[model samples]
Target: MLCPRCSLSETRVIETRTSEGGRVVRRRRECPSCGYRFTTYEKVEERGILWVVKKDGRRESFDRQKLLRGLMRACEKLPVPLDVLEEAASRIEALLRERESGEVLSLEVGDLAMEELRRINKVAYVRFASVYREFTDLSNFAAEIARLIEEREDKHDNH
Candidate 1:
């Protein structure tokens, strides 16, 4: 690696560690000539799965920010922390990467989001599900609420 201070092309790695669940490698390096020390991170660049297939049959590249934005909109004014949202996004990305086919349907992504949101906050989950599932009428929203209530009741009964 080139030394940032002196523009020297020689450097030696002093330390290395894995981060982000081993998805990245953090390396500490020192310039052999100038003695400048710096750190760098290395990550395997895997081409992510193809874009989500919209219900209307449109395809686009997967965008992390867009996904985060959707979740953020749903989580607006909720007590959910930014770290929780980040962790949720990371989990979703990891899950998508695990698919052997290297492709996932839009509905699948939406389901994953809903699952995470449900664990984080019920209101946020409903907000996201309503828009993502394209609820057409009030009955759809009511049905979702009813389902959530039933789920909670079932959990309470089990406990």
Candidate 2:
């Protein structure tokens, strides 16, 4: 692995752990040159190519970075940790693979992202939902917040 700080081409893995039911490998690496330490994840890509079916009926290759970017944007300026979002994205990808389809609808991707973001942070969830669902006005935001409150209430009641 390359060191993010010094841009060294080599790094040594100091530790390794399997996570998310063995779908991901987390590695702690240290750069010999600069002594910088960082973590990286290796995910198992199961398929050759996955396509995303957008709302306009266009098919394009699924890009995990796009999902990461959206999640990062939603969690920006919040207390949400980057690693938390990364793990959530990994889980979302695993869930996508569970569908057993070569292609998945864009809306499905958004839904999964919203679900993970909701669990990680509610403010981030609303940020993602507003963009993914295309909220038009304050009433839309109000309805979403109200629904979130209701969901929390239902969960507490169940307990």
Candidate 3:
């Protein structure tokens, strides 16, 4: 690894450890030339491994941060925690990676996120669904809320 301070090509790893539930590997390094110390994180890149096919027929590389940001926005000012959203993002990424086609629709991603949010928080779910499903009018929101209520009722009956 190159040293950021002096741009030296040679660096030695001083320490190594796993983090974020073993999803990331962190390495502490020091530059021999400049004695600069820095930390580097290594994680498996899902980039180019999966593609998101947008509604307008454009294909873009799937980004986990982008997905998490959307979820955060939906849960903004709500009681939902960041860890919940992070886990949901990770689950969404994992499910997408399991696909054999190497491609998934943007709508599919949104639906997956909504599923996670719905289980975590109903308000957040509706907030996400409103934008994901493009709720332009009050009726759209009402219809979604109605469906959500009906699902709850069905589950209650089964229980």
Candidate 4:
């Protein structure tokens, strides 16, 4: 690795750690010449088309960061553990990859996100649904919450 301070091409990794459920590697590096130390993270890059078909008839390359950002926004200040969210994202990604066409509808992605968020936290689920479903008024939130409550009640009754 190149040293950021002196632009030296020689550097050595002082320590290495895995995080993000071992999906990412954190490397502590030092420049021998100037004793500059820095940290870097390494992640695996997906190798596939994985196009997303949007509602507006536009297709775009799949962006994992974009999805993670949305999840984080929903789970913000909600006491949801970061690893649980990451695992949900990972499962969603794996599900998409299992699809044969390498393409998925935008709504499908939103639905998957909603389901995953619901499994993590109801507040997060509603937060994500409010945006994904484009709530225009109070009724939207009320109806969604009512439906969620009904579903929970039904599941409880069944048990």
Candidate 5:
């Protein structure tokens, strides 16, 4: 690594750590000549563009910020922390990228988002689902809430 202070080409790493669920590498380096110390972070560059196949058949590049915005909107006024939502967004992006095909259906993305929200907060899950699933009637909302209740009951039974 190059030293920022003296523009030296040689720098020795003094410390190394991994964070962000091991997706990021942080390194502290020192320049021997200038005795300058600095920190750097390393992250894997996404290999290729992942396309989002819209419901209308229009294709666009997958945008993490857009996804995060949707999640944030659903979580507005809730006790959920922004960092928790950010981590959920990162996991969703990683899951999408792990697919073999570069293209993903919008429905699939919505499902994944719902899954994450359901784990984070039930109210937020319903909020997102009402929009993404286009809940047009009270019955729709009731059905989803009922499903959630049933799942909780089943989980409790298993435990």
Candidate 6:
């Protein structure tokens, strides 16, 4: 690593630690030529997953931001914290990485988001599902709400 103060090319690592739950490595380095110290982070670059096959048959690379944005929108006005949203995103990414095919269908992504949202908040879950499933009318929205209620009831019954 180059020294920030003197622009020297040589540096010695002084400390190292894992960050982001081991998703990245944080390193502290001192420049050999100028004694300047700086921090650097190293993250493993995952190979690109195959493009998502859209409902219209269009192919596009998987985008984490898109997933995050949808979650943010659904979570608006909900009591869920930002950390919860971030953890949900991290979990989704991990699931994608675990897939043997390295390619995820758009439908699969939507399902994953809905599953996470359901655990976060019911209102948020319905909001996301309505748009994601393209609800056409009030009946469709009502049906989703009823389904959620039934699922909750079933869970309670099981316990």
Q: Which candidate is the best by lDDT?
A: 5
Q: Per-residue lDDT for 4-74 in model 3, tens only? A: 99999989999999865678788999999989899998989765568999999999989899999999998
TM-scores of all predicted structures? 0.71, 0.80, 0.74, 0.79, 0.77, 0.73
Clashing pairs in 3: none
Off by over 4 Å in 1: 1-44
Q: Tens digits of per-residue lDDT for model 5 on 1-159?
A: 889999999999999998667887889999999899999989898999999999999999999899999999999999999878878988999999999999999999999999999999999999999999999999999999999999999999999
> Could you give me the TM-score of model 3 versus the true structure?
0.74
Candidate 2 residues lying further than 4 Å off, grouped into runs, are: 1-12, 19-21, 28-41
TM-score of 2: 0.80
Q: What C-alpha lDDT does candidate 4 achieve relative to the native structure?
A: 0.91
User: Which ten residues in a row are the worst by lDDT in model 4?
Assistant: 82-91
Candidate number achieving the greatest TM-score relative to the actual structure: 2
Pick the winner on TM-score between candidates 5 and 6. 5
By TM-score, is 4 or 5 better?
Answer: 4
Candidate 4 C-alpha lDDT tens digits along 46-139: 7778999999999998887799899999999989887788778888888898898989999999999999999889999999999999999999
Full-model lDDT, candidate 2: 0.89
Worst 10 residues of 5 by lDDT: 17-26
Rank order by TM-score, top first? 2, 4, 5, 3, 6, 1
Cand. 5 TM to true fold: 0.77
lDDT of 2 by residue, 56-152 (tens): 9999988888899999999999988787887788788777877766889999999999989889999999999999999999999999999999999
Tell me how far the alpha carbon of residue 26 in candidate 6 is from the true structure, in angstroms, after superposition. 8.3
